[model samples]
Target: MPETTPRGLAGLAFGGDYNPEQWPERVWDEDVRLMREAGVTMVSVGIFSWALLEPAPGTYDFGWLDRNLDLLHANGVRVDLGTPTVVPPAWFYRAHPEALPVAADGVRLEFGSRGAICHSNADYRAAAANITTRLAERYADHPALAMWHVHNEYGVPVSACYCDSCAAHFRRWLAREYGTVEAVNEAWGTAFWGQRYSCLEEINPPRRAATVGNPAQALDYRRFADATMRENFTAERDILHRLSPGVPVTTNFMTALSQCDSVDYWAWGRETDLVTNDHYLITDGRRTHVNLAMAADLTRSVAGGAPWLLLEHSTSGVNWQPRNPAKTPGQMARNSLAHVARGSEGAMFFQWRQSRRGAEKFHSAMVPHGGTDTRVWREVTELGAAVEALAPVGGTRTEADVAVLWDWQSWWAQNLDWRPSEDHDARERADAYYEALYDHHLTVDFAHPEADLSDHPLVVVPALYLMTEAAGRNLREYVENGGTLVVSYFSGIVDEHDAVHEGPHPGALRDVLGLTVEEFSPLLPGERVRLSGPGGAGLDADVWTEFVVPRGAETVWTYADGPAAGRPAVTRHRLGRGTAWYVSTRPGAEGLAALLGQAVEDAGITPRADLPRDVEVVRRTGESGTFLFVINHTAADTEVPLDTPGTELLTGERAAGRLAVPAGAVRVVRLGG
Candidate 1:
């Protein structure tokens, strides 16, 4: 066996995607030398090299890869060998044109882009399996092999296909899931649309419809597409597990709220040997670091609080966004260490060298086109040394002070057509709630609706439109057991099948919230409402409002003016031993912070009020000791309170009482025993 060690690293795993094929053979020596200089321990190789690996059908070219792996191993760098199954070669596509994905409007997407394969096609599956098997067989015992990267970022670029092959595959999946055509019709609620199918053969993928398609049907197709992608992933993973016995297998996940929303990460989290995610900042004028922290926390939660890897991030700006502004000096290191503080084993970037020619030539890399003199190179080398200094913090887990409920399926349901208002975006609500908690300097762990909530002192349901009975019961039980809960509007209104819960609005949570929503009152564009209460004074809300009737709850805030003026806009209910707060309208940022502040007090959790704004503090504990990461995002120097004296990892200085962190810097302290 090559290596059974965790990610083939004794301490921290650090590096980027290494594409040796992109450069000349003479450059390989220099690349490895630079890698060693930067303290790179691992590099993901051959992720998009299918065309080069199998130039012609069934003709393999392992000479180049063999030499590359050998060279990496010689330099003491481990390899995350990829299966090369993401992008098929041109010859394979010419042979199987039907493998291309078709859009919802019946347009077949042409080749030339990555992730173009129709996952449901047999020919594509056979080709993928063959490539995966070939790579596994050849590198099973290679000394450089540490982990098997099955495919590069599944569900990106293309997820769902509307081709005929996918339609047939969808029918089979439905048959297995529903057992009968009648059951499918019932679950999909096809009776109202006059679209009930008598046989499974008559059904098809939710294709172009005259009007908006059935919400339930669209929802199921999302599930089916996600499962199909997983099927391909698991097939590749199984081949690697059998051929390469001790190596762990994983496919990178894009779990950020603004990124791929098709895959249910909770399910995918259970399938991988190790959970890894790729996060990029979407700089749209909002706080990018907050989104980074949220993505890192969500990824760690998906890993079941175990140490996960930051598989791929840009060293600076990304090319795909509308604006590709380069990061400021020292921002790269701060962004990287933030992830490490949230439970990432280490930080890795997109590519080792900035591409000279490609669709992503402008994308940032560790070694820019300016070579070793650029600011990016300086920060990259500095980050590498920083990672090495924090090796003692490896394997430690960050403890979360609160939990946020996140479900991709619920997000999918809310994003469908003909909703009350397009302004009611699920992703926006999630980001808002996470930002509120982050401003309070609270560490958050995202949980599935049905996951255990007993451990978290506080839980926030941002916006869950599709809630099953089990999840509702779970929340009720959690609150009854003394856990503080905060639920937002539009939650628990529908069941798993998109059917409205029978009786009152918010069907599943009416009892738990101690209030009933008689009707949804959505505001027109540019309209707003004022809220009045001790915590809600001068608060303005918009996008949505509800006519709430308090039953066994006390009114915390009332709509001072709007369509639902004087109605209970926010209510509080006391359950068995805990408290539940409900917000019936979207409040302004200050209002949200105030409401959450009350919930934190109710949970008996203290906020770090002494710390300045934008400074982040997180703790990671393990058998070695406790490590405190204080990241200063502000412009002025600030002092952070420390309970125990410890050695600062970065400067090798002994810190006691309180530590002064300079502006735009990160400090990791290894607490004394």
Candidate 2:
């Protein structure tokens, strides 16, 4: 086996999760043979094999793991060794029942699956650290070691705990944050509902209450839970860094999915050597490829535009969806290339081989239940070849002129009980904005509110209800320093502690936006207000509506017919050579497209190429040259016009002027000398 550099795997890693521990010793040989045939460069091992690695407490058994590592090394496959702290052995729970987490309703959650241990438990942390130390010591000098997978997806099953230990930890965390009981009360606005606490022990996790719980307290608890998970990850990561020097360490992130709301990837990215993410298709919506591109873009931004890894994705239909429909003929290849187009150095799936019996038996893998003769295996092999051909794209960066803000704290605050509308879903709102940009064939990157904004010409913030003072200052500075900003409805209404800002609605941003909201008139379900803008653009606004009186901003659009008719539905204010546009209502897809399109043109931003409808185009640049990825996501074939002449790596043909991209296909062209 050939070991890769300490930074990462040598070439584009084209392998998936390989659980050789689940099979017989004889099967390992067959797996390795197939790996070579499929061009697998790396494999993630021991993700959920804690019980097998350490059968008993303070006891170690490495004979099986040693054999598997040797076999993989002999087969020329690099290893992404997992610490196996995601799943605790049953004996662990039996010996230390105190490690179990309690639900919001005070019900002790029994562990029958992985990731059920409380993140704040002392025993669990100690045990996890011990295993990580042992693994790092044993594999530090191994020939096949490529990277260290710190832990499986954090906060997947159980994000927070309400146990006594966790409660105490929460009090200490709050004390460290607020300093005193009076400060905690002031931050939470506890005096409003006579819920003020005089001592640290009086506080606890947000449990069920008679009515809606305190929004500020709930927001703090969400932050505490995310921090606790980060603490757990850092503990193990520190041990690995000390024991195994020069080995890159990372934990897979679930980007933009529901499970990711509890953990902040913006903060987590600072701790990882390289960022990686697992994105599954949303079968119910049938727009899986679009969502995959969005996730990839966000993941790349989290890595600061560095090439990251696509750790997990389904080959075809996933078993978790209500209706698992397998991918169409060329859908698999299109899906994988989409990630690589957006700066992913590697393309990988959830598992290598299909499980015979388990919860994921129906889930598609590289080698499906039908074996290598099936279409799944054929597509997997073809994808491997395509990835190998795209080795030039490795270590490249994707360029985007626009950025959309993503904040977990705002997500928590917006969804908190007692809001303007029950349909205030943070993920859906952000996706709608991203989808509009994607439809226009414009590249985008996800930006944290507090991150540097000078790189992007235009920044779009959708439904950022809770804004920290620093984040608010950053946005203001961005606008004042000549950066265009687009803020949708229900943004900047509160500060970091979920406290409403004084003065007008949209609190801290009232000055920058040059508008004030007097009242909120939420629409009933299935109700909408007609909006008409300049240049014959019109659409219906649903979910929420705010009556805005512009003080300095000029009206760009107004409500046509509704209770809030003749009012400003959209406005734009110019400050310091930059523009700040605000949408006062939830505009439908067409309206958003029209408004965003105008914003792009106004900011002097140009798309990489003028693509046809449903055709996605992105550019990646490196020392070699610029690579243009044109993917036709539609069902019908389309001809994409390329501005620069270059060789198409997939077909070895010199392409220029116009290239025909087949339906559900992709073409990678290396442009420039």
Per-model TM-score on C-alpha atoms: 0.99, 0.97
**Runs in model 2 lying further than 4 Å from the true structure:** 1-8, 535-537, 607-609
Give lDDT per model, in order.
0.92, 0.87
For each predicted model, how many residue pairs clash, with residues at least 3 apart or on different chains? 0, 0
lDDT of 2 by residue, 86-180 (tens): 88999999998989999999999886888898989999999999999999999988988889998899989789998889999999999999999
lDDT per residue (tens digit) for residues 368-424 in model 1: 999998889989999999999999988899999999999999999999999998989
| Alpha carbon deviation, residue 203, candidate 1 (Å) | 0.7
